[model samples]
Target: MSFPGVRRCHAHRRAPLHAGHRRRTFGGRAGLVLAFALALALGVGGTAAYSALYGSIPTAEAQDRVVVRGGVVRLGTHVYLHANGSHGAIGITRVALVKKCHLRVYLDRQPGDRVVAAVAEEDEAMARLGVQAGISGGIDVVDVRLYRAGRRVCANDRIFGGRSNLWISVTTLARTPRKPATPAPAQPTVPAAPAPPTSSVEPAAAPG
Candidate 1:
């Protein structure tokens, strides 16, 4: 055997080099993972920026307005968005009685203008309509409205929404003058029998 000390030194030098190589390899892989994460974040940011700038609204509209009179209800479809810098829409958001908590509400807007309205799929939609119509009292509880350019555009069916009023609901219902109720038909009465051929009446004389 050559010197024991020399052998030990040689072994220590080789082990450190191997460990350093492994450490460098791990660090390189860690760096790559971090770079990939950054790239993904940047990509998402870019997409958001493009969407905000381009105004790429969905071709399909949200939903139509539910025209009603004086009903404070939940509405979800009419998502008011600011189209131009000057024009904007206001919408009322209320809670619904249904389990899923959809929305019951009233709506009014320009003929083609779309407001945000909630959409239900199967049985949920049916039940919602039933309840909304069933609770058809003329009074609307919540008052909310949407205004554009300082003009009233739409509102909660029962209350004021910021600036607008629930004035357009008249169109959804008929307002005819109520006629007075007619009197009941008179009852017929039977006259009392003339007292059984009146005991006092003289009997007719027999022709003798």
Candidate 2:
């Protein structure tokens, strides 16, 4: 019966919450989502960068080098040959990127059929662009390098003489020319004594 008050809508009422608990809950969930998004973004960005770097994949040829283990490479033994008639050696690209990072290769060419280079046979596009085994223009395309216990091999000075970066050293391994030693100088000769006839004449003049 007293003065009546207007009824309030349920929607207008503030819902109950466990003090700061709701804030913490919301914060935790939001943090998780943000973290996931960040990770995804980083992954995507990384993939994009990689694609851009080696994306311009060339139209590969049917004949290419085979990759073995640990990024070792080898080319067609018959395609790129040495000047001396030796079969072309397998090429080795230290860490060539294939269609994906799924293949492996060993450095040295083993006594068997296998791809020893890091680059895949499917993506051996470099070959089409004049890449091959042997020392082409003073670069070892198919190098025979040496390595340390925990270091990658240097691609220079590995060939018989001056390694080829993308090709073999067609220049055969000739013996380095050794210089001949010169002989010692001869001793000087002594001069002969003066004529005895002059001595006799001079002696007579002195007595007079």
Candidate 3:
């Protein structure tokens, strides 16, 4: 009843089945691990990307003057105004002005003034408007100019003329504070020696 060749064939057939089971188990575990890793990567990446982009947008307040350079939005720059908590749950609100290089400014939610974007909270604003198109819609001022050595320059003139990325300051309707000129480096001063006291008597009348 014991035929060596037949027994060997049966053993060989069973060997493959056992090996197949192990392979399937390992493959299933590997697939699950791979999927989990991929999901984690995507989640972490999305959060970090969102945070980075959000940080780039500037924050300002009513009557607060902020420098606006080319921010996340290339059309111009986006500034989020601090919102009042009383405004219920909160929402990302925006008012776009199509004007370019016209020196537009908005503060305290005034009427009839063109604005870039005003938000309630940074998260709300960025989450909502971060990816929107045609964000800038306009330039803030006239000719771009930079400061030169030995020149008298105004704040607007300096912003336009300087090499800085931010050139616009949005403030309340009231006159905004001018950018203070950089004071020249102070130089050391030497005190002059007091003049020698002279005799009050006629001793000063040398001759006779």
Q: Which one wins on lDDT?
A: 1
Q: Write the residue-wise lDDT of candidate 3 on 99-159 in tens digits.
A: 3332222223323334444321112222233321111222332122122343422223223
lDDT of 2: 0.33
Write down the TM-score for model 3.
Answer: 0.20
lDDT of 1 by residue, 80-164 (tens): 2212454332332332333332223433323333222222221233233332222221223222333334554321322222222
**What does candidate 2's lDDT look like per residue over 79-189, in tens digits?**
222233443343333432223321122234334332222222212333333332221121222223323343433322222122222332222111222234687898898
Looking at model 1, which ten-residue stretch has the lowest summed lDDT?
165-174
lDDT of all the models against the reference? 0.34, 0.33, 0.33
Off by over 4 Å in 1: 1-96, 99-174, 198-208
Q: TM-score each candidate.
A: 0.18, 0.15, 0.20
Better of 1 and 3 by lDDT: 1
Deviation from native of the Cα of residue 126 in model 1, angstroms: 29
Off by over 4 Å in 3: 1-50, 53-65, 68-136, 139-182, 200-208
How far off is residue 55 in model 1, in Å? 39
What would you estimate as the lDDT of candidate 1?
0.34
10 residues in a row with least lDDT, candidate 3: 67-76
Superposition error at 139 for model 1 (Å):
8.1
